[model samples]
Target: MTAIRDDGSERDRVLANGAVMAAGTVVSRMSGFVRSTLLAAALGAQLHADVFNIANTIPNMLYILLAGGIFNAVLVPQLVRAMRNDPDGGDAYTSRVITLAALFLAVVSVLLVLAAPWVMELLLDSRFSEPALAAQRDSAIDFARYCLPQVFFYGMFVLVGQVLNARGRFGPMMWAPIANNVISVAVLALYLVVFGPAQDVFGAFSADEELLLGLGSTLGIAAQFVILVPYLRSAGFRYRPRFDFRGTGLGHTLRLGVWTVLFVIVNQVAYTVVVRLASSGTASSADGTGYSIYSSTFLIVMVPHSVVTVSLATAILPRLSARAAEDDLPGLSRSLTDTLRSALAVVLPFALLLPVIATDLANVVWGHGAAAAHYELYAPSLALFGAGLAFFTVHYLMLRGFYALERTRTVFWIQCAVGGTNIVAALVLVRATDAEHTSPALVLAYSASYLVGAVISYAVLHRLVGGLRTARLVRFLVRAAIAAGLSTAAAAGTAYLLHRAAGDPHWVVAAVWVVVTTCVDVAVFVALARVLRLGEVTTVVDTILRRVRPRHVPS
Candidate 1:
């Protein structure tokens, strides 16, 4: 009975925290949609968008490649340990981390700025070197130079945000990205107002245009980092420059970080290959979509993961680490497995429904100005990404388990397989298709890669944890798939009938169809979940119900 009560309490705490982060993520994503839409409206979805998108994106890719893996996965557990074991409650360690990270980011950001031309040369394709496309490629390199400074801000934002997370402050980190989105929206809006939409989809941006878009992007990132400062202070993190890196346990953290750094190296290398391939997709064809379409659709597919799995895992990681610290493998396994089931209970439905709504969803997102004519190009990649996202959610959670166990080396090796699969598949798949099929092919590569990742990571973590309650997990997966399958069929049937009834409806009507279909899908899924008695489903549903249910007052 006590154990049941404890589980309930744990779930409630996790759900409450998850809810806050999810709400912030939802808002941030909605604003991000506006931002992406504006981007499409301004630049169209082909070479023009790809040039700016890829250039502005390099800083983030570099940041992640350099430090994000260690900061995100490795440091959280280490910070948790410091807080628990250190007499000063990890303040010195946290400060040292901040100081060292800031120094690293500053130096790396400077070098990256110097190497911007070379970086663009590596990431863009051979087609861009042609005389006709040389101007566009130069424009991309210019944009990268302006945008590389964002590496420092992005690293700091995430590093500080992780500090907050380690201190049991999660909402601020999730919420602070909204500031970045809002700034981006403003920047794009200003671009539209000043320069208007790009006249030629395949044209290069002028110098002035690059200045606004590139510098504006860096400004947004800086603002995002600034927004976290107050929150850091409020979270009781007083930042002092602790230069005494010796005898301060920094070496231990760095030792653990080596494999994680290698992990990100593999990840970023694969991504660089993808970018190179994607860049060629647009340059090789006048009207074909590439990096921009691939990235935007990928984000849409990741909405469930960003909202549900990430938030849930962030809130649960501290507890899992605590269990591991106590050497309670069974307890840690139980919590990890339970969290996995709960997350999949929410994510599976999204995977099934995405394809049904892909066309309409694309219309709603990219159907504006210069983008409207090509918005449909996003649908195939979008549809394929749903499978990828579901696979990635599983892989992501399994990595958290490994992190908790300080199994960074194992995670690195697993990521190598995933990354290798992505690079090989992308190289092979893209070779077989034209420009139009590029994004879809890449999506297939992504899905296939993570399927490999999910299987390997889960099996390894299961063994490491003595058992990840595999029988229970398999049963839940089977039942959830059944429920989600029926729900998807119902949703698809409704969509088909609605299409017949409305026959080439406008965006408003299409949106109405999506709403009605989603309603029916959820209703059927809930009914079936109840019938199947899936506790994970019941726990989430009942918790939501309890939140919205009316409460009687003292009167």
Candidate 2:
């Protein structure tokens, strides 16, 4: 009975933490949507936008290539172990880790800024070197110079957030991004007020305009990192410089991170290929199809994953690590399965219905200011990305499983397979298709890559754990697929009828369809879940009610 009570308490704690993280994620994503919308309005989905997007993306790519993969994948488990066993509650170790990471990232950021031009030339499409795109290439270099410093801030934010997570604080990491998005939205709004939207191409932007955008973006990242410091203090963590690094188990941590570094290198190689392909579309005659559109659509598809899957994973990872540390494979397996089911219960419906209403959703989100004309460009890729959402979520969760087990090499090899597939498929698709039409195909390749990743991850995880409740997971997924299909069909048919009756796809029509279709789809899904008696659905509903309902007052 005591064990059962403890298990129930643990379950409740996980749900509560997940709810907090989910709420934070929802706020962050909503703010991010605002930020993206403002950016789209300010820049439009053209070459100028592509240049800015690509330049801004380079910092993150560089970070992953250098340190992000290690910090993200290896540090949490190590920190958790330290917290549990170390005499000082891992304080000195944490400080040393943070100090070293900051110094490393600072050096990397400076070097990257100096190397911005060469880096741009290497990562960007060859079309940028052509006489027509020379100006765009130059602007990209300038933007990179300003944005590259964000690598340091990005590393800081993730390291501090991981420290918070190790101490069982999850909400701050998820919530901190809201401040970043808010700052970015304000900057973009100011840009719109001042510059009045970018002219058609990249060459039209002046130097001051480039500085405004580049510096504003970097400032937002700085703000994101700054806000987390106080939270770390509030969590009883104080920053103290610890320079003594040798013989402190830091070597072991670094050794564990080696494979993660390789993993991210492979992943970045694939992303570089995609970036080249996507950016090539900017040179095409298509008005709104390019890297910017692909990136924006990808952002939309990730909303559910970020809000649901990431929240659950963050909440459960420390616990998973604890179980793995204890050699409690059964507990770890149960925890992972429950977390996966919970994530899919929410994500599967969105994945299914998003494609059906992608156009309306895109218009509703992006149809404002100068962006209205290009809103339709986002739908095709959004739809394609939606198809692979579940697979991507599964793959992410499986990677976390490996991280908990400290199996970085296995994770590295799996990413190699995933990245190899993505690179090959992207090359073929880009070479075969017109640049203007490559967005959907690129998205398809993304989904396929994850499909391969999910399969490989599941097989390995199943074997590692002696069994991952594969039969149960398979049955649950089948039921979910069935329910999602019926929900999507119902929603799509309703949307079509509504569109026909409205006689147009105006923003107003799109808005109404978004509302009507989402309602009908969710209703159908819930009804099917009831009829099917899906346990995950019940768990989700009960958890939500538990969160929202008023508790009885104690006498």
Candidate 3:
């Protein structure tokens, strides 16, 4: 009974933490959407948009390539161990880690800036031909030069934010991005007011225009990093730069990080193919599909996963690390299973319903200013991405499981397989389809890669953990799929009727239909879950009720 009570308490704590993180994610994603909408309005989804999108994307790619993957996968377990066993509460170790990361990233950022032109040449599709796209190529390199410095700030932000997470402070990491988005939105808004939106070609961007987009975007990342400093202080962590890394077991951390670094390299190699294909499509035509629209659609599809799955995983990771440290395999397995179920309980329905409302949602979100012209292109990509949402979420959670076990090599190999599949699939699809249709095909490739990865990861993780309640998980997933299918049908039917009544796909009408259809979908899903006695759904409902209902205490 005591053990059971303890388990229940832990579950409650996890859910509460997850709720806080999810709330923060919701706000961050909303602000991020606003930022993207402003960007789409200002730039549109064309050659100009692709130049900025690809250039802006490089800093993040560099961060991941250099240190982001290592920092994320290895820090939690290392920090957890230090917090438990170190005499100075891991303060010195944390300081050393931060100093090392900062120094390395600063050098990397400077070099990347110097090499921006070459980097752009390598990353942009070869089809950008020297003669025809000279101006576009030059503009992309210019943007890359200004944006390359973000690598330092981006790396610092993740390192510091993960430190906070290790200390069981999750809200700051999730909320800090809101500041980034707000600043970006303001910058884009100013651009619209000052220079107006860029059209058709990259030749319109002057030196000042390039500076506004480039430096403004970098400023947001700097702000995001700066905001986390106070949170570290509040968490009782102070940055006293300790260079004495000789004795602190950072070597062990780096050993673990080696595989993580390889994992990211594989993932990025596959993404490089995607970037080339996506950017190449834009170069093929003045007005066509490219990275900007694909990225925008991806952002929308990732909202639920970011808000729910990421929150649950982040909240539960410390606990999983602790259990792994203790070598309590059974406890670790059970906790992971519970967290996965909780995440899927929310994610599955969202994934299924996303396709049903993709068109309406896309129109309402991106159908403004110059962006409305490309709504038809963006919506189908979003729907295709929706189909793979569940697989992506599952794959993400499974990788975290591997991280908890400190099995970075396993993850690296799995990523290799997934990345190889994605690149090959994307290449084949691009060849088979026209430039206009490549976005959805590429999106499908993204999903298929993850579906392969998730299945493999699940099977391997189940064995590593001794058992993952495979039979039970399979049963729950099957039932959830059925429930989600029914919910999607209901949402589609209701949305179709509303569309027919409205007679036009105005933003207002799309907005209303989306809300109504979503409400209907949730109602049907919950009703079916109740009829089926799905324990996961009941657990979530009970948790919500317990949080909302007032409790009476004796005076």
Candidate 4:
């Protein structure tokens, strides 16, 4: 991995970090393949949806407690400063923070477990009205209860991951999530074999399949936390379970944590509401199935999105934290700009083209199901949603910037505006649509609103920073769009023809078409980027190829 420079542009650091982040992300994503595929096959779409819905909710809630407001945005940056200034003293401080965080997460997890039923009913009341739906709700509640303690582990990972990130030691840190996913998938596979699916596991006890799945999930969580201990040890950090927050910047971390909680809470509400909207009109079991389908499809889409976002944020944050610690504005600004451009370059085509091939790709990877329509609904949204990642990432960077400066309120307000917009759009679009399915519409609205928010955020951020260099970005975007547009058109056409040729097995044929077309798209995208002099793409590829071929290996 390339070491990030304090003097380097944000773009350079983001690219370097993104590459590192991408490594972890790709592994995590591959592991997700194991997790999701097994989950899908074992649970099927309906139960899978419940598993994901509950699983997704757990992380969001945990982020609030662990990753929320100021901890990530503000407290972490402050901690990074202390560490840079005095590594020994800072380690002591971090140790305290870790202690405090674990306590907080443990208490919260217990409380949440106790309150799981009420919580589930409250969040998903709309879907649980029918008797069948009530059963699913009960299952989710039980599942959520068992999996709640994973929150502590989740918080530990983020807290530690941020610490690693600050030191520019990202490769192992990023891979931690892959470990988590791999563990989750393995546990799930074991559960399926021993129990013959979640329903069967619960069959003797009249246990809800959702609840049983949740039980299996916690086994995965154990893996998530266990793998990180070794990584932390390698980084020369050990967690002693002690709480000495007397003067360890606990006040600042808590203050930031409050806002982080608020922001995450709002986001979680919007997401759940949107899912509830999607489940409308279906029978309770169908609703369960619909939600599961959406969850699985969403997870599939998130593989790329998560990879990009996490990579960009993880790569850039530490460097930004370092610069912020030193109050280096010009260095920070330049770096921030570069990060945005690099993120855009990497994410643009996926954002644009995924919708075009969403269904084909979904059918290929997930196979067919009642919830297949859910995937179709989600695919277009994924494409459109890619537009906002850079903005969201920049928003995160800026928040981290502000947090480093002890500016918590700024992060809060921005999240409010953006999160509020997302909620409103989700509600209005989801409710307004008259189509049999509303989930896609809900996703589209949510995704498109982010696009709008990004534009606004970018404009405001640019004004704050004086100006951004747009000529190069504009040229690249235009050329890349044209290339992707043409490429997708070709891929779609080829898939259509192959579909006709394959007759009954159109999905199988479509799968082959996606691979072929994507290959073509990649070739065209690279060619276009090279011709347009988009240096980032070439730089990334060159680095990868160089790494792949050792100096002594004759290719």
Candidate 5:
């Protein structure tokens, strides 16, 4: 198993990594669809939104802090160095680090559980004024308690998973999330079916609905943990219960990890603040239904965001680390630029299409409910928020570079600056908006924050790389915008035609629109790329399809 290099022709690496990551992500995202659908059906939008928003925030933050934020940034580079410097002790170092991370995260999980009440109070903001609403907040906190523990399991899983990835055993790490989603969907279904009509188990109707959902979902978390053990074992790794601090490489990781945690805390706190602003409800109602609406909408938009972020981050970070170690600055620069272009190309259609079909997608996936209004509010956000995916992907890759050079503090402060801007923007937007509406204002604020941050990130990268081929990048963006416009029109037309012909069955309409939009988007982009002599676009698409195509398959 030869290690994949992130040198020269970085566009090729980006395309190859994007394809694999996208395929796996598609499966995991499908599972998310199933999970969200089930929860919506079982508990309606308000309850489902409440649970999803809070419960996810816990692990979401943990994931950023550990696996995504710190672990990849810190763990991979350290492990790679260990493997290079002391080949014989590679396994021992891996084992000790895995043990320490697990123990540390386990303690963190306990602390989070203990502090759930306070965390919930902060996130829910004005949403929980009434006694019933307060109870719902407690229910959310309990659910958070259940979901938070999985961070420990997943954190350890990623530590070992990265080792496998470092060894060129990429398949298992890529597919693990699919298995986790499967377990989640299965458990949610089982709980709903078995406990749905039982008043004692589903406390939504009984005095204990909150506890049941909390405990039941925790069982789902345990299932997710169980699924990863075999994958870990197969990767020639095992988690032993030990915490060693002597020459275990914790120092290198800790410096980065602490900053990474702050970065994540700032990032998530901004998100939570947005949710809080929206949840604070309109000044007129005081019921906080606005928060519910925003929460529901955010979940739908996040599907594409998650898919894009995970796809690129998982594949690019390790390779970026290796590139930095060799001081291959040009290779690193090319890789980052190519990845940005390709990621933008890939995500643009979704960014356009989602807003066009937001109504149908929301109704189909979540059903007609109080969430319908929320969906509409969240629709434009899909495009605005989705466009940021490429920028965020670049930011993720750049942070990895920072870590590869062991510049943890730089990564930390950069994140804080970006995240702080978002928080302040959200607060100011909500404060300045008319008392009657705040959700859209907050969403706009978020989008604006990303825009500003992305510009800063690009400027920093420019200084670091001694400048990129701005002319080429500008041309690509122009071409991509044209492609997106054509695709958006195609999606809108297809959606309208399908609705008129089929009388708008949500599921069928969504399916047809997805197909039509995807085909048109790809076709138009390819044509524009060729017409404009954008070789990178053609080169990337050709390389990706070539690599993935079966021997028996035609070119």
Candidate 6:
């Protein structure tokens, strides 16, 4: 392998690939929001929603706690290396990895299901154990029993997706989640037709409700995993399960995963604290907020990071791995630095606008069915999440750089600082706040944690990669901040006028404000990008124009 110079054609290939994944992510997220809205509408955005949401979320949280860090970050570089260096093109190694992971996930899923009550005890606040809330506690535990089986499916989906990503098939992982969302949407619609909107937002689910909601959630996750199997064949891997995992370089990969597992453990510990705190919000009061409000709004702010940074990072990881393999630290630094700038150019404006359009955005998404009365509850958390998402995008992409170099130990230490901060901050903040303000306080803690993460991740990765051009990165941040800040002001001003014109408006008016404000926001950002000669934004505009407009076809 050779050093990957940041040439125009190479950059275009990365951008084009990133764009394909981004497009898929865009559709998936839209569908996901639809599913979230349906859940909010059907369950209402309080304790009732928290029961289902918490139960459903535990499988994912547990999957990550158990094996997610290994599958997601550590193994990609290993897979890329195996594919390149192994005698039979890594197919044997890949099959063994998959087979072993499948067996592990299956065992863990069953164990989790059996341990459902204990799991709920660990994650739920003391309020759940109160005599008055016994029914709700039982309901949450029952849901956990039904949903714990999703652990197997979630692990397989991500494991399969990461395999595909290593083979340079980036679009499928991004697109496959739409299937889950679709299945969920259908289930939620069926529930609505059968049960209608939620009448008791603070009540426990009936047996029928548990069967439909919990099993339906698991089925969607199963479908998500099933959707990826065909992609394995398409990516030229015909998987025949290889159980011979004793004498290969598998130990090396596991050694790397040890640190990543510790990293994930720290992360999940912090999350468990936050979950318990957030759950206590709605459990302690009838007119209170909780996990559903926090998680859904987080999903909303994560769009920019999920679509832009994740896509870009996934597309570029193989290349970064190659650079590290070649010991081309300078090339790795330059490549990562460039990707960072491109990601921030898109992320910053969206982050800035979240505060500007938080209420409007919340209303458009959650302002229907049972949640309509409480849709406004999402605004403060939505506003606070922007900064966290921004900080996290940096930490996330920086980890890709470390993963490329197999620096999992370094990543673990950085995460310790981050997780330590989150746990302490969340415990303190949640103690001082009322139930209505629970989500926002939790978001503040989240932002502070990732702020520590962003600084340490960048600083550490910068040192490891030789130099990530600190001076250049600082300039990019300043320019992008100016561009995004101005654009947000424009959007905010337009939103103010729209509100003044439509006094005491309906959800429809809020929806309209979101659409119009977004347009004006982007238009202003484009003008500013050009005026400032920001290459990141200008290059994207040029690429878009080149594709959409009539071009000279030189034969």
Q: Tens digits of per-residue lDDT for model 1 on 157-259?
A: 9999988998999999899999999999999999999999889999998999999999899999999899998987888879999889999999989999999
Off by over 4 Å in 3: 1-6, 201-204, 541-555
The parts of candidate 5 lying over 4 Å away from their true place are 1-14, 62-68, 126-132, 191-208, 232-243, 282-309, 368-380, 432-438, 496-507, 547-550, 553-555
**Candidate 6 lDDT tens digits, 105-216:** 9999999999999999998889888898899999999999999999999999999999999999998999999999999999999999999899989899999999999999
lDDT of 3 at 441: 80
TM-score of each: 0.97, 0.96, 0.96, 0.87, 0.85, 0.97
Q: What's the CA RMSD for each of the models?
A: 2.1, 2.1, 2.2, 4.0, 4.1, 1.7
Worst 10 residues of 5 by lDDT: 197-206
Q: What's the TM for model 3?
A: 0.96
Q: Comparing candidate 4 with candidate 5, which one achieves the higher TM-score?
A: 4
Q: What is the lDDT of residue 265 in candidate 2?
A: 92
Ranking by TM-score: 6, 1, 2, 3, 4, 5
Alpha-carbon lDDT, every model: 0.90, 0.87, 0.87, 0.61, 0.63, 0.90
Clashing residue pairs in candidate 3, if any? Answer: none
User: Which stretches in model 2 have alpha-carbon errors above 4 Å?
Assistant: 1-9, 202-204, 550-555
lDDT of 3 by residue, 81-198 (tens): 8988899999989999999899899999999999998899878888666677887888889999999999999999999999999998999999999989999999999999998766
Candidate 2's TM-score: 0.96
Model 2: per-residue Cα lDDT over 358-411, one tens digit each: 888888888877677778888888888876888999999999999999999999
Q: What lDDT is reached at residue 138 by model 1?
A: 90
Give the per-residue Cα lDDT of candidate 6 at 474: 87
Report, for all candidates in order, the number of backbone clashes: 0, 0, 0, 8, 4, 0
**2 or 5, greater by TM-score:** 2
lDDT of 6 at 554: 100
